[model samples]
Target: MRVLFVAAELAPFAKVGGLADVAAGLPPALARLGLDVRVAIPKYRAIGERAQDFASAGTFPVTMGGKDLTCSVSQGIIPASDVPIYFLGHDPYFDRRGIYGEQNEEYPDSLARFAFLSRAALGLGPALGWLPDVIHANDWHTALAPVYLRAGAVDLMSRSVLTIHNLAYQGWFPIDQAAAVGLNEAGRKLVASGRQLNLLRGGIQAADWITTVSPTYAEEILTRGEGLEDALQARRDSLTGILNGIDTSVWDPSTDPHLWAPYSSTDLAGKVVNKRALQEALGLAPTAAPLLGMVSRLAEQKGFDLLLVAFERMMAFGIQFVLLGEGDARYASFFRDAEQRYPGRVRALIEFSEPWAHRIEAGADIFLMPSRFEPAGLNQLYSLRYGAVPVVHATGGLKDTIRECDPVHDRGNGFLFAEYTAEAMLEAVGRAIRLWRTDPEAWRKLVARGMAEDHSWNRPARQYCAVYERVVAR
Candidate 1:
């Protein structure tokens, strides 16, 4: 089966989040599973000028605002994979320093930018004679792919699947701009009083199947829109959630080149070397203290406020803390103050470094991910692979991925706190610290068990292939 993936970002090219990771990893896994899969994304500044293995396909004319606009198409082979990647390059929209907007705000021309991309993707299927069996679209950026396929002019034989990585970002455009993007009369009628063009809603309404990242998240979107219009509830039968999986090769601690020492379930004594190295890197005193580390976007939704509250109390307990990320100003300032307050105990890195992130996963004794609502986090899975015990709030993928330790049996992966309160977070941290300080045998078991579990994309990829087969069969 031939599958075409339409997404805004792909790994090592233009990645701002997990969506890019999925776009790059899942398709390659599917290709290895004997399906022909290809990726299509807009050419942004981060992708650089010359694309590897990229060859010009001449200019294709696209109409916007009743005027013709020609976009250049370039094709490249995805590194270490048999799948092909197609890029739609145009100067006006995507030639910027960042993938999204400069600040937290969305780009003003985002609607027109991605609208062209979606239309171009559908238009290319016939032009290039590569008619896919299914077109899988991700997020609001590529939400118009389904709508484009449903257009009468496009003789699209492919069924479309829409995956909502996060329901928070629905592409809202002016009602006047709807016609420019090929929104039909019926679609326009469904708009609310604002008459805004809700691209995600249209895609969810138009697609043959709709999926989110987790089962809990899928259920959560029903009553709570999360920017997904009430139409989410209307299309209840079609919507489903499939939890995400990590690429084990990228996250494995046993062979990770970034680690100070390589260690696995069998030989976990080397984990201490990584821990010491992490302590040194964070400017903490090289003591045998338990370290709690976090690598996430510093935003309110990630429960940073609660983390601050917990940390204020946690500082009295004498545990080391390290953080690495770049996000909102308020959180950054808060962490800055904390860094000054506890110089040797707390360290915060305001950047996104992949290698350093890997080191954190390999080294930290405890990983904290207290997200208010996480769709499907990859870090907790990565932490498990590294034998770094996770102390996470029981919500979304955290609940799905991390198994809570049975105090009686002593046979689980990590610690799980049910409530999203600061007290609950501190309690969970205290539990992790107690385990580290007191229970040697249980700590060894937790580390061993966490390392033994599988969180690879292999299983999830097969499940996706099954979903593809089912959708095609229908």
Candidate 2:
């Protein structure tokens, strides 16, 4: 199968969140499965190095808003792989300081920017003389791709697959602005709602197949579909939720150079060395108390709203806490205060550093994820690989991946709390702590179980291939 995967972010080149990692990891996995896969992303100015290495694939016209805008194409290879990736070079739209915004503010012309991206991605294949059989568009950024294809504006017979990363963000815009996306009258009606135009709604209705990050998350979207619950429920039979897999090659603890010392499930002595190193590096008092680490955006969706309340309650557990991420001013202020209040026990770095993230995964005894509504989480998978037991809210992918630690039978991998309240989460955390303080053998078994499980992209990639085949067959 010839597949063209399109997304707004591609790691090492342009990355804003988990979507970048998915764009980076999935195509290569699909390539390994004996499929011809290529990737396309906007050539943004934020993508440092200017992508000068990419060979030009000539120019093409993308019609949108009743105007034919010219876009140049550049072809390059995915880092560490032979997958041919393409870039849509349009200085007016993508040449900006940020991928989606500047200083947390989204670009006002985001609708036009991404709509151009969708149409340009469709034209890229023919510009390079490599038309794909399947066009896989990701998230709200490229949601209009399927819409244009359905309108037959593009002269391709290929099927399209739209993957919803987060249902909360559907790119709702003024109905007047919807004309800029280059959809025909018939296609426009599908996405129009009251006075707004829902880009994702159109894609969901037009795409041959739909997928989300995780199986449980897939089901959750039926009711938790933000504002489009009815549309999702109508398409429930076609939507498949496949759990996302991390890039084991990059996330593997045994070989990661960012850690103080490499460690595996078999030899945990290095884990102790890493813990002390990280504690000292972060200026936290080095103690035998279990070190709990969290690396995520400190936004409301990530459960910072709940963590703010749970912070004081968790301090009583006598565990050292370390957080590394940047989001929400309220959460940042709170953590900064907590760090000062508990000088020796708490350390919060309100920033995003890749090296620190890897170090936290490798060094911390327990990893924390308390998302309010997670579609699919990547850090828990990283934690599992690094032998860091996870204490996550039992929702979406967290519910699918983590199993409660069975202290009696030694059966589960980590701790889970079903209720969204802080007390429920603390109860789960208390259980993990009790096992860590009382039973060393049980703790080791729990860590070993998580570490031993394969969370690589190979399986998920195969599952995607099945979806693509089914789409093609239909």
Candidate 3:
């Protein structure tokens, strides 16, 4: 089967979030199953530097506002996989410093940029003389691909599958701009939602199949009415929530080069060494205080506001806190102030470092991810692999992945709370801390069990393959 993946970001090449990781990881896994899978993404400024070899495949004209805009296609091989990655080169649209935008502002021409990308992706198969059986589009960026396909842009024998990584971003724009992106009367009807052109809604309406990251997230979107719950409910029969899997090769603690000491589930002594190393690196006193690690975008959706509300109280328990991430000026400033207010107790690296992420996962006794609504988090899965007991809110993939620690049965993997309040978060953290301070044997069992579980892409890949087959059959 021939599959073409259309996404905004592809990991190691272009990445803003987990969407990139999914685009990069899933294609290779699909290829291993004997499916001919390829990925198509815009050739952004950052990707040009890392993409090794690139030969021009030719240019095609995309119609926008009754004018022909030329888009060049370039081919390159993914470093360690057999999957081919196609770059849609349009300097005016994608040759920017940031993929979506910079400084917490989206570019006004985002509609034109991604609309061109969606049209260009559909144009690639015909240009290359290799029509795919399935075209899998990811998130709002490439959401218009399914719309384009259904609008008779291409005559290829292809079925479209749209995966909603996060339903919050719906690629909304003024209805006036619809015609510029080739949204005809029919396309506009599918996309229109109260005077706005909803790109994700268009995809959901046109795609043969719709999928979200996790089963819990799939059900939550329908119930939460997160703006598109009505549209989602309309196509409930077609929607399926497939839980995302992490790339084990990249997240494995045993072979990770960023770790202070490499260790597996069995030899947990290295975890203690890594903890001490992290304590020294962050300038925190090497006491037995339970170290809480957090690596996330400092935004309200990630529950940073709640964390800030309970920060002082949580710190009063004598637990050391370390944070590494950059997002939202308010949260960034607050966390930086926390470092100064409580020296040696709170360490906030207001930036993103891949090494630090791995170190934190390996070193910290407990990882915190109290997201208000997480689609499918990779960190909690990584935390489990590293034996870092996760203290996540019971929602979305966090609920799917982390089981609440059962002290009696000694079967659960992590600590979970149901509510989205600061008090609830503190209570969950307190539970984890109590487990760490009191019962060493049970804590070891919890960590060991988490590490033993499989979160690899193998099973999810097979599930996706089955979905592909079903979609193709339809």
What value does the lDDT take at residue 294 in candidate 2?
A: 97
Clashing pairs in 2: none
Off by over 4 Å in 2: none
lDDT of 1 by residue, 1-474 (tens): 999999999887888888988887888888889998989999887664665547776668776557678777888867778788888878788888878888777788888899888877777676677799999999988878887666543567899899999888788878898777665675554432266887888788778789888887888778777755478887888888788887777777777888889898999878888988888877898978888889998888788989878777887778888889999988888888898999898889988999989988888889999999888888888888888899998888888888888756967899988888999998988898998888888898888888898777787788788778888999
- Arrange candidates, best lDDT first: 3, 2, 1
422 in model 2: Cα distance from truth in Å?
Answer: 0.8
Give candidate 3's root-mean-square deviation (CA, Å).
1.3
CA lDDT, candidate 3, residue 260: 88
Task: Note the clash tally of each candidate.
Answer: 0, 0, 0
Query: What order do candidates take by TM-score, descending?
Result: 2, 3, 1
TM-score of each: 0.96, 0.98, 0.98
